[model samples]
Target: MNNKEKADEYFSKNKSKIKDSDRPVYHFTPDIGWMNDPNGFSYFNGEYHLFYQYNPYDIKWGPMHWGHAKTRDFVNWDRLPVALAPDDEIKGQCFSGTAITDNDKHILVYTVHSNDKEEQTVEIGDGVNYKAVSDKPVIGIDKLPKGFGGVDFRDPKIWKEDNVYYCIASAKNDRGFGSILLFESKDLLEWKYVGILFENDGKYGKMWECPDFFKLGNKYVLVISVMGMQARKRKYFNGHQVIYFVGTYDKSSYKFIPNGRGKTFDFGFDFYAPQSLYAGGRTLSVAWLHDWSNDLTLDGAKWCGQTTFPRELKLEGNDIYQMPAGELESHYKNKYHTSFILNRNKEYIDNDLNSRTARFDFDIENIDADKLTLFLAANDEYNSFIKINMKKKTLKFSRRFSGLCKDAIDERKIDIDICDGQLSLSVLVDRFSIEIFVNKGKEVLTSRIYTPLDANEIRFLADGKLKIDVSKNEIE
Candidate 1:
């Protein structure tokens, strides 16, 4: 059978295995099998299209296809059919890439990986139907950098600037160092190699994956997912971390002058290979919410992997601020509110705040506490805690006691300042994940936790007196 016939039969036979109770209400997950690394995120014909690496036959990663979905708003999604599948000639997989709209045609540029060579290919389609633009790669392996082998050449992020199409792809040199290659094309069918856009300075990582370059505000931002970098002191972890560099782009010379060392894009354990699109005058992004280390927990479920909530990216100074995007308030209901003052060494419990899927907004003032702790997804058997230290200006998330999972990363901490003795926090909890936006997205944390399905309680404790106003919205 052909590749399309195989995908159709796989979907028809295994579609019933997916269970609604195991899926998240607000996040985008595959209906069956496994998904990872969001791809081809673009706004086309008044709708947002999101594609990802998918394996339709099982809950584990395997041969990859382009799984497709679209949404009018970022909150609600409609899953489409599989967009692209592996061909017999490729005999490997279709990896991650991006999409672009040129005049009237929608085009997809992606990497095809096999055992011997990695090549770049293209496809054309509307939102529903797509066809391969060419049987051969537009940018073939012979066209890559001379000294560098084609092992790590993949993930082409394409965009247009001044009527010229630009593509940036990740690669590793013969010396086993990571770099990003740049290419320019007058038309989408042909391309010429530009020089290396950016390379690691020996401190970053051995190989780079998923390189995205675009202009945000007056500065250009480059986002890369790095592999094989050792964990630094209080910064990124030991493997597969996404980082971004804010800099100036000289369009005349096609060179990037970065301001400083890149910063960690997200401080959570679950975010990686995020792709962004410019839509409605904003740079919006979404990421695969599970990392390589946490993939073992989803073995029993029929479906695995999910995307993080869409975030609006804003550049402030040298840093980027990310917040929940596109009117999230519309999905939340059953409002609850309260105000209280917590004395030293006291605890407050509100049964009304309990929910499996809820949004919590806290406004804290006149803080005199050395530390404050909030427990979520709590029951007699399991709980996850978020601890805030006012004096040290640090926040920590701990899931050590969160039930049903072991041998995963349990703690993540970040240094965040309290402004004018005040803190504003917004927490979104789904069935198996928690996303915390601290001080209005100045510092954010996204993590996954596995608790008893019945654990639905909220608790707050403080070391000193503080006035707090809290609101809860249960999301359907």
Candidate 2:
């Protein structure tokens, strides 16, 4: 059998070793092995299919393959078979890319990582198994423009406008920085270069990767994950960051002109390489719920990495507001809501609202306080907290007490704007992750926690009076 067949057999046999209790309830992960950077999120066969960078032989990243999963709604997922594998003939692994629907056939254009150079190739399949359209690379090293090299040319983001197809991939030019080169194709196999879409100005980061260019509302947005950024301020905290640029894709000139600057896509500790899909009149997205780290979850659960909960994105005044996919409401079991005045030096603990797998939507309408803190995923032995400071206009999230990790990141702080002395916070707590949306996605924070599953407690503490209304729902 070939490498693809061998991979499929290996995953089919090994996935049974993992239990459902070991995985996140509402998030997507690999069947049994390592999963990273979501690739090819598109609608086909009446369902949404997400392809991810997969390594099935072990619980850590290795020779890359494409793992597949499908969902009609965003919350519930049906794991599909391993889609693509490194070919023994090509002697490379499949990297990252996007997909598009072509006349009932799902077409994937992705990068193949070889010994030295990376190249672009095509694959076509039904929702289950995919094969290469051609054994040879379409955009090989010879076709690259002057100053463009082969190794960094990967993560092809493709979209269709009118009858022509457009694709962009990140490449490091001779200038020693990153540039996004645009190309167009009449057919899926052949492509022609169309100038640069956007190039790095040297201030953002180094090589940009996993780019997504799409239209949201009346504005065109370009999303990219950058490498080699240093953490000097509130932004670029990850060093490797996922950021977005609001601009116009001048179809006439085939160039993107930014309005001003790029903004942080997610102000969380663990978010990168996110891709967006425009489906059903909504712009939906999901990112790898991880950052660049040598110490992942391989030693802990024999399973590593997860995808952020799918979000519905919208453009409201050059800012993207993300709402958890509406399909999640079907999983709510026991929901309790309360409105109260939390005075200074008072602590409020709700037994009914404490759950690891739950959702809390709380609004702090009237604030007369210097500080507010919420302890979540808490018990006597372990607790994680989000502390908001009114004078500092900042919020800090830390998971150091949730579990012990000497090497991995445990905390992050971001600038928060509380308009009119009011703040709305939506917290989605899973068995191993916490997703917080501030003021309906004005600023969002996502982090992974390793606390014991039984440590499910929610407590509120404040320094001064505040009017709060909280709605808690148990979501599996």
Candidate 3:
């Protein structure tokens, strides 16, 4: 079958297996279909607006549309109409872009992906990337300025500074170095090139997707997810990731100070393709939590990817920390678990083993043990383990569950240590992704592990006398 036919077939098989939970601790496949890079994230007029790459025609990834949703509060989301669909001459799809309110009116600017049936790469000046509509494409390639390497550019993220609109998009150079193209637009329409941000000088690996620029505390941060790098060569590599550099932006020179190397936003296997929007005096970021490499689960799970909960990015002495938005606590049902202690080393004996979709805040005061392993979905032979290696002062996590068809048995490891007076963690597990927020979102580890549709057994254990209070919250 052709690409379209294969996509439709994939969608039909996993339609029922897809999970779109309304509760706060659940997973959701977008109402329409495939979704990628979170776009146009803004809180306007007392409402939270979120748009993502969507393919309504099928469940599989393809030419995207701006799938839209809004909420008075983050809890109760209302799926709105498809904000931007393919209405332009760009043949293949609407790739990805950001949106902003242009003078009290909601206006969207996105990268339009056009693939000629005969040509592998179409010239941006020849025809591609214009405004799009649901029924048809908008504008023509001829309307754009006639210069710059065009086909390798898209994913526009526009922001305003000192009354001027600035956008940063991803592009490749004539020498094959991946870089960000900068543009200046006064009325959101016509544009002028404003020097490339960081040239693909072979230092940053390769192509950057969903480039975003914002200010946090005293530092200006440039964040982008890079692709085509391997795990051993990089710090964290599942597929793409949200990596960034902190520097100073000079408006007069229109340049960013080259800082040190970029760092991974979250040291997790699942987090990637992250984008950010600045509002409410804080910079909030979100990312797709599934890998583009080794995409073996897409056929079995139906839905392809998921996004981490909104995080507030803060810079503390040259290091970036991600904390979940405080407003999310409003969705907690207040149902918490108190009494909790450890018994045997192999099996969990006490505490609460109920409520599959919930949150856990754990505080351990004192504990003596060679190893402390907490189980999330534990059974006779297989279980997901979050082990604290007291000997190494490290916490390692890995998972094993129902569907085990993938090549690797599906495991992840990270070095996390306790801080301050205690260590805190917030766990959110849907059917697919397990997001661990360590120490009040200071350190987050996101992973995609396939568990049986019904594997919901959780327990905890410590090597010695473990004094800890675990609060489990059920969300409405």
Give the number of the best model, judged by lDDT.
2
Q: What is the TM-score of each candidate against the true structure?
A: 0.97, 0.97, 0.83
State the lDDT of candidate 3 residue by residue for 1-476, as single tens digits: 54334434544554565455422244434654567777777766667677778775655777677666776545566766565555434456657767666555555667767653110111111011223233232222332233435566767777777777787777755665567767776755455666767655565656777788888888888887777654543255545666778888887767877467777777666777677767777788877766666454545334455577777888876677887666667877757677555554656544344555666667765455556777775555545667776556566667654354576425655556665325667777555666787766656777776655455666677777566677777555
lDDT of 2 at 277: 90
Q: In model 1, which residue pairs have backbone atoms overlapping below 3 Å?
A: none
Model 1: per-residue Cα lDDT over 306-330, one tens digit each? 8988899999999898888856778
RMSD each, Å: 1.5, 1.4, 5.7
Off by over 4 Å in 2: 298-300
What is the descending TM-score order?
Answer: 2, 1, 3
| TM-score between candidate 2 and the true structure | 0.97
Worst 10 residues of 2 by lDDT: 293-302
How would you encode candidate 2's per-residue C-alpha lDDT over 1-476 as one tens digit per residue? 87767878887787778998888888888887788899999999789999999988877789999989899866678878778888776668999999987778998889989878988888888878787877887877776888897878989988887888888999988876888898888787788987888899897789999999999999999998999876757866647888898888887777999887788888777889999998889999999998885364745575788999889999987888887888889889888998888889899887887899988998886567888988999988898899988778889998879885546777888898887778889999998789999989878888888788889998888999888898998887
Clashing pairs in 3: 87-133, 87-136, 87-137, 88-136, 88-137, 88-138
Give the alpha-carbon lDDT of every model: 0.85, 0.85, 0.62
The deviation in Å at residue 383 for candidate 1 is: 1.3
Reference-based lDDT, residue 118, model 2: 88
Compared with the true structure, the alpha-carbon lDDT of candidate 2 equals 0.85
